[model samples]
Target chain A: MIGCGWGLVYGVLNSLSNIMLLPSAPFISIRPQIALPMAVGILLNPPAGFVVGFIGNMIGDGISGFGIWKFWNWHLANGLMGFIPGLIRYFGIVKIGTVREFGILQMSVVLASGIAVAFAVLLDVCFLHHMTFPSSFPSWILPAFLTDAVNGFVLVPVILLAFRKILLTLEIRTICLVTILLLLAVFSTAVSITLSILDDLVSQEAVIENFYIAGIVSVFLLVVGFLASVVFVRRFTDPVIRMSRASQEVESGHYDLSLLDPVSSRNDELGRLSRVLQKMAKTVQERERSLRQQVQDLQIKIDRKRKDEEVREIVETDYFRELKKKAKAFRSS
Target chain B: MAKIIAIHSFRGGTGKSNTTANLACLLAREGYRVGMVDTDIQSPGIHVLFDLDTNDIPYALNDYLWGKCDIARAAYDVTKTLGADATGRLFLVPSSIRAGDIARVLHYGYDVTLLKEGYRQLIRQLPLDYLFIDTHPGINEETLMSIATTDVLLIILRPDQQDYQGTAVTVEVSRQLEVPEMYIVLNKVPVRVDREALAAKAVSAYDCPVVGVLPHDEDMLDLGSSGIFSLRYPDHIISREMRRIVQRLTP
Candidate 1:
């Protein structure tokens, strides 16, 4: 039920992107729709991903007045794009928890796009008897792979983020910013290629070639940037996370702060903060101990009010008054 | 005229008798002719502390209260018993320890007036500079009569909850009687207690001067009531504290 419902939605979205007149290569439409099935593949099951991609592409082709069975190779290519990332289910990762898992999710998307496009090219060459090899590589294979790979790479994390499948840690936040930059780079390059085609600024073949190269270069840059961000952000935020955990320990009345030694020795603001926290805990512990001792030694319980009343009972008597008179008379005598 | 000093407590076993015996020896050591009367008629134990043997009593305070003898006849010059080097004379009017004598005083009760007259007779006869009244614990008619005539009142107590409450009442009573001078003496305090601090606390507690906070002495306990603690351990910590109390009371 989920597969058919999502497949129809993907088909409608694909048709909508086509109508939007976005910057794209000749005969290769800019397909942000590529991320939808890949996200579903990773989020849902692999078979569900295949069903969404295959059936969705078929519905899309039929809606655009292109015969669905005519380019059956393209439907299979899209299906494989979703199916490869869906293989992530075997890693026991229902959601991205660490930097390594995030890398795997993105790498699978890129890997799936390359293999899927290659599979289609091989089928078109062997079964359909499509003309030419080296010439077809640039126009069909390169364009197909770059379009799917870049779109899926940039948008899958975004979809996963929106769906709450990824935790918004420091590493994930940096990666989110990096994805937006990649999308901007991809968008600008596509627009320049489209302008080149429309205004006749350069030869179409040369322009298309440069577009594919720029797309691939940006993907590598995004990968390197993602890795560097993971390293840098993890370094900055781990100490904070550790200190937060130690503070919780202190709150619960456990003053064993052996874990904070490294953080406290850093000679930074956080280290100074750690030292202050440690001193506060020690002071609290000392006060508690001394309080217990003082309660024993310093207190001598006596009720003065009650004693004053009791003393009044003996003094306010006729016998005491007469005795006081006789005692005073004798002392003067 | 001798200055009458009454030593008292609201509860027994606060070392009241022992402290009286120690102070008498301490005062005489300073060459003041001191006279002490064991007014703890119901259960008198002060005579034992002065090493006054049971058989040596020709007359106790019981004889004078009964009008059987003059109060001076009951007075014994106990100064020589503390050693011949003692300069000033020290006298003790010990309470009788005989079974019938104790029972008659408890049963018929002594005239409280005679105690003041006896104190006057002792001062005139022996010409004492200081007269010590070793009072029985707790409030009684005679205890009040003794307190009423005193020039100075010393309330002794131990570091105990019952003692704390009892001493507080005794302090209020002495204050109401308009005693000329008043002070507290904390005795048999735990040796580990901070003496200076306890002394300060007691002063603030009673709104009265604290002349002493005496530590519990093992030797004093070992000696029990058979001998004077100040004379036996002249330079002992307890003796030193007692001497300090004497210094505060010297005027």
Candidate 2:
């Protein structure tokens, strides 16, 4: 019952967002809000995610006068986007702590987007007469895949982090901050360019030409910016990875700090951390060595004392004295 | 039959001579006829423990080995040195302490077989219950000869790394030589080490019984090589440890 209620609300919101699309291809426009239902699905149970996504997309098509049954395959695809992320919770990956966990979450989001879009195109080929191969692929498939994947990848982690489901590590915090800034920069640039192209009093052909040129430039910038941010973020995080591995070696009683040499040589906070860790390992190793030596020495001391007391008791015995006297007397006779 | 017991070590300064002197004295005090031979001709030190003047020794083991005298002539009855209440006999076969005698022996190594024969002759002539051979550290011809003929071989070593490694080599060689009974005595151990653990480690490393772990007693160090530790300070920890080791070696 709660799933149905969420589905209705999500459907209405999705329809409203769909109406505000930026012009792109003839049949496919950029849809950024598609991640909302998917995020909600993953946050809740799989059933809730599936119902909300499927019902919402149907209601959206119905309200847009496209008829609910017209894009049934796309509705199912949207339902799957929510369903896949919900599976992450089943796998006990609701909380992201390490880099590996975060990578898995992001990869799943991208894969879900690709799979959903591909499913829709497959359905269209088998049943519907709308999408054709190669020509329709860039317009229908590429736009849907890129927009949904980018949105889900960016927004889901942000939502999870905000909900405190994902632990906020230094690496996560920096990446999130940088991503938000980069998104803002990209969105404002594209928005201003789009608004100017729309408001132009030039001919329709000129408007179309200007819009195409702006879209091409925006897409090119997005790809370049994403790649650049990845490389830039890696520089700050790589040392952390190296230091973590070095600490594991130290924990296992290996005092060799040569592996952390490169990290310690750097002139940054991470470098200082690496040096501190190396120092800690050295201190521990020294303590263990001294302790072992002390233990060995203590054993000898205790043994000496104990053994001496034992011999003293034997020598002082009356029996031993009597035996000595008898032996001396026997020798004399 | 007299038991020939050889006290050996792989490295010097492991208290082998001190231990040999003390063991001999302790046994003699217990009414057993003990004979101690300073087979370490190059640096004979057991004579000093008995307070025997090197110049007073008219016929030493070197003289016996050089065919100048009988082995019994080199044996000195030092039972009086035990100072009263020592019911048993103690005779010492002092090595020639003269620098030329030492140089001559080292330059032209003495007959290893003759030295073994001398030990037998000394034991039989003195009617000794036990004859202790104090050997030089490391594997030399005389040391090997002494080890091969001994009824018991006591390997002395400190708890130091160098001593431990050298001791292992000596132990392995003794085992290969098929010595009847072999025991390890960890000497000069610091008071801080765990005695039982060190004994266990030594036993496991060499596969030999550990007779004693003698700590670095201040009395022993202060006394130096002047006197027998067990006889001087009979109740001292080091002396007691020596007694225990002697008891094991004899039995």
Candidate 3:
């Protein structure tokens, strides 16, 4: 029943994607709804994701009055897209805890699109009596792969974030930023490449194909560079974030600072700062304990030293001296 | 030879006279010939510890200080006042408690030298081993005289902030006088006081050794300075501390 319900919703999303047709490519549409089944796959189980994707794509084609049986391989392709990402569940990633986990989540999305599209192109080559390499590569294969990968990479995390399964830790934040920036870089590269193709320089098939290959290479480079920067930022900023949190703990008078052990071991300036803060907090706690005991001794907080001085002035007078002398002399007698 | 022991306080209600009475009584009970002179002529209260009525002081220290009678005539044999348990003799030279006479002595003050001289004569005349002077509270001429002439000086003070200031001054002044021995006796201390801490504080603050810390006893409050606390409740803490004081003063 769950599968059927999601399948209907996926079908609705599929038709919705078709309504917003791509402006640059004639047959292609902005299929952000492709993320629905992929996200479900990672969140739930693979069978559920496969059912949703296959049935939903079938319903979508049926609603448009297309021959669902004629293009049955595309439905299978969509099901494979969902089913493969659901295998991330077997990686035992209960949640996206680190930048690496988030990177894997996104990598799996694009990988699923690559595999599913390759499978469809393969089926067309052998069974459907069409060589997809030169013909369908431009129209079907490239369009489907690029659109699904890009859309799923950007939209799947958003869905998971909204579900609160991916906690916004420092690592997650860095990964999210990398994802957004990567999307922008890829989108701009794609637009320029498409514009170049439309610029009358596209008559050369080899040049257009080289540009397509360059665009794919640059996207990989952008993703790699952004992920490397995430690691760089994490190495530098993680200790600073930990120290700031430790400072707050000290301000609240909680001096147990075993939390900074990793930060303190780095031998960096941040590590020195962590060690200093831990020592200072312990010293302050000891001083406060001693001060509390001293305070307990003096209930009224009297200025006994000053008062004693004043009393000495009052009693150590000329007459008191003379009298003491007289008595001292008298005792001698 | 009698040792002149002056018990003085910088403030009143420190149980000074009671301490003197107890020390003198305990000394006499221990077979030491002890004589206590009420040199606190202005506010003499040592006689009350012995239940010695003002009417019974036939010839008071006032008459002796005023040259109206010999100082020995004023010294009353008060050992029997402690009842049959008292084994040795004790003498107390009481000050004039008469209303007219108290006014007279205050108005026409006697010489501090005369009180010093009288202490000597009473010690020799009574032939006492110990002559205890119960000086009046505060830094008056006669009290200073009594403090200065003493062989042993025991300053009584409560564990009070005000008393701390004065007790410090008293210890300094007594030290200046070159008394052979001096000690502090903390009196009327609250029950919860850390006694060792208080003694250390007192010793460090005043530069004097502390002999005893007498906790505030309910029985002492009940007695209200009318009778000797050590005699009535010998086993009580207050009495026990008084005995310790006597031991310290004697040793």
C-alpha RMSD over true interface residues, each candidate: 2.5, 14.7, 4.6
Tens-place lDDT per residue, model 3, B130-249, is: 999898898777777777789999999887777777776677667767788999998887766677787887777777889998887787888886877788788988788888888887
Cα deviation at A129, candidate 1, in Å, is 82
Model 3 TM-score on a 0 to 1 scale: 0.49
DockQ in order: 0.29, 0.05, 0.22
Q: What tens-digit string does per-residue lDDT give for candidate 2 at A189-307?
A: 86757667567646787777767776776777677777777876797678878887887888787888888888788754577788998898889998899898776553322243443
**Chain B only: TM-score of model 3:** 0.96
DockQ-based class of model 1: acceptable
True-structure lDDT of candidate 1: 0.82
Chain A TM per prediction: 0.62, 0.57, 0.64
In candidate 2, residue A53 scores what lDDT? 80
The lDDT values for all models are 0.82, 0.78, 0.80
Best by lDDT: 1
| Between candidates 1 and 3, the TM-score winner | 1
What local lDDT does model 3 show for residue B187?
A: 87
Residue B88, candidate 3: C-alpha displacement in angstroms = 21
C-alpha lDDT of residue B5 in model 2: 89
CAPRI class assigned to model 2: incorrect
Please rank every candidate by TM-score, starting with the best: 1, 3, 2
lDDT of 3 by residue, A175-234 (tens): 666666766677767766766665666468867666787777677767777787778688
